[model samples]
Target: MTDTRKSTQNAVGAPGRAADGLAARLVVERGAFRLDVTLTAAPGDVVALLGPNGAGKTTALRALAGLVPLAGGHLRLDGAELDRTPPESRPVGVVFQDYLLFPHLSALDNVAFGPRCHGASRAEARAQAAAWLERMGLAEHAAAKPRRLSGGQAQRVALARALATHPRLLLLDEPLAALDARTRLDVRAQLRRHLADFEAVAVLVTHDPLDAMVLADHLVVIEDGRVVQEGTPADIARHPRTDYIAHLVGLNLYRGQARGHAVQVDGGCVVTTTEDLTGPAFVAFAPGAVTLHRERPAGSSARNLWRCEVAGLQSHGDQIRADLTGELPLAADLTTVAAAELDLRPGATVWATVKAAQTHAYPA
Candidate 1:
């Protein structure tokens, strides 16, 4: 939490910044899926590639690590081009989602494998692995096999193994995805500290927003193999440009053209806001700002009201989220007690209203 979030302005250079980092334009082609992404990171920066499943997040990481061949584009690290380099030959290290520890090898040997492959002597590699294990707080589990170690312990060993080579680029694909929620929190904090201390470019791929926000200095959101948005966590969270991003940040978003206080959404209902906006604009509001009534309320001060039917309802923490469809389709958050009092259910008719002041309008 102490690490400052960096701006994602240029993927290549920044004013007064060092050049010893990663800069890559990756393009990969499969049967139908294509991933074309531009990525950059500073020496002490941690970048996170975040998106939904099958959104080319992992493909980007693979391209960076040389696991997947690039159809076109360049990859450079520390001012050296590495587009044609092999995975092992490149100064890159990878921690896969599954941990992928060697089943037959002990923890120490697993951590030492990379050093040994890089031409270090057996004794030297083991000694270096022991140091890494101790750093990861896993020295006691050095003799344990992959199956014998806990999930958290195995994850640390994998990280230690990847770092043993001291690569310039560190790539992690869902680093904490294999662990349970409780263990994930613990490991995530540890991983954040490790990544912060790493004096090289680190790129992590994850679909979890919390993980992306917590571990990285900048976030690159990809969808359908394209870079949809890139910025610091706060920037992206506050001003999401796409519906996917709006959903991720828990906002009801609509694109429209504004005239004075009225905005007519494309293919959706019109929204009225207190802010005076003109031309192309977007309207967004939190679910909690929406007020639902069983019957149309008379003399209500709210300017926007829609007659909708409950399409679906689900529990969200202590509140309930209602998906409504009609003049305006939106998700609204309601307290459990209020939901029960109204006997809210699918197909039920409800009048939803939002005060003009609650809706935020901004230029698209």
Candidate 2:
């Protein structure tokens, strides 16, 4: 397994310079589950915690917010240790998944609440809140209550509220989850702009790959409470280290022993690849790379071919995704017309082929 801590630490700079940014090894134990992951980010960096449900993304966020107590390890921001700090006292801002705007308060008051709690006078808090609302383009909705505002407006109010206190660290838990698909697209673009203007470290938790890829400067992929991969969005998408990541990035991934350009994958299926690799290796190819036929193709030049059974089928946008089993269990994508021509359905046998040029192999 990769030493994600070392890699991340190196990416941000040396540990001795942790004072310049956010540095922490979060360790939290709950019943049988434990999360031990190292996270580091310089000022102005946006790090997204990308993981599946129950993968400890939320737990790590809570730990940073001082809501969840740490079993071991420390939390530090801008050189200050915050492990024992109370949630209310930490210089951190959190935007919950649900927005959590005070239903009774107007948007102005909701935004001013954070500054008030941080010891600003009513007038000063309101002044700061007003500026943040203006920055968020929600100044016209100052008097609107949470109940009267649209989902997008309410989310902006929540974000404005979090930013009023001038926090050194911002934590957003699925900031765009409440919006509709159309609203999400607009709000996501807006949020990306806002995050770019932020001068402090920001950490966001999300399961949406598109959101993470678009909004985060770096991605930390957590699985079963551990860091499985951490890198730029493009890097992780190009070279997924785990099955979850492979699926998340829309690729069919397999592990096996490599001999030159051939990989002996699971089920004794040998895959021919374009890269020359040896020893333990991983082979990955996009589902679209696979071509399916009712019978084996004769005089085909493709070096990688398998006899597979269609275990299931589902719509994926304009294309159909077929889950296959047998010689090599994998997912394949084909056009609706092609699928119809093949008479693809569960339990149907088919021959799948992929050119060696489509397969990528790398040392595991």
Q: Against the true structure, whose lDDT is highest?
A: 2
- Alpha carbon lDDT at 137, candidate 2: 88
> What is candidate 2's TM-score against the reference?
0.94
Model 1 agreement with the true structure over 264-313: per-residue lDDT tens digits: 99985899998898999989999999999999989899999999999999
Best by TM-score: 2
Candidate 2's displacement at residue 250, Å, is 0.7
Q: Give the local distance difference test score of model 2.
A: 0.89
Local error of candidate 2 at residue 244 (angstroms)? 0.9
Candidate 1's error at 20, in angstroms?
Answer: 2.8
Quote each prediction's TM-score.
0.92, 0.94
**Among all windows of ten consecutive residues in candidate 1, which has the lowest summed lDDT?**
7-16
Give candidate 2's error at residue 296 in angstroms.
Answer: 0.8
What RMSD does each model have against the real structure? 4.5, 5.5
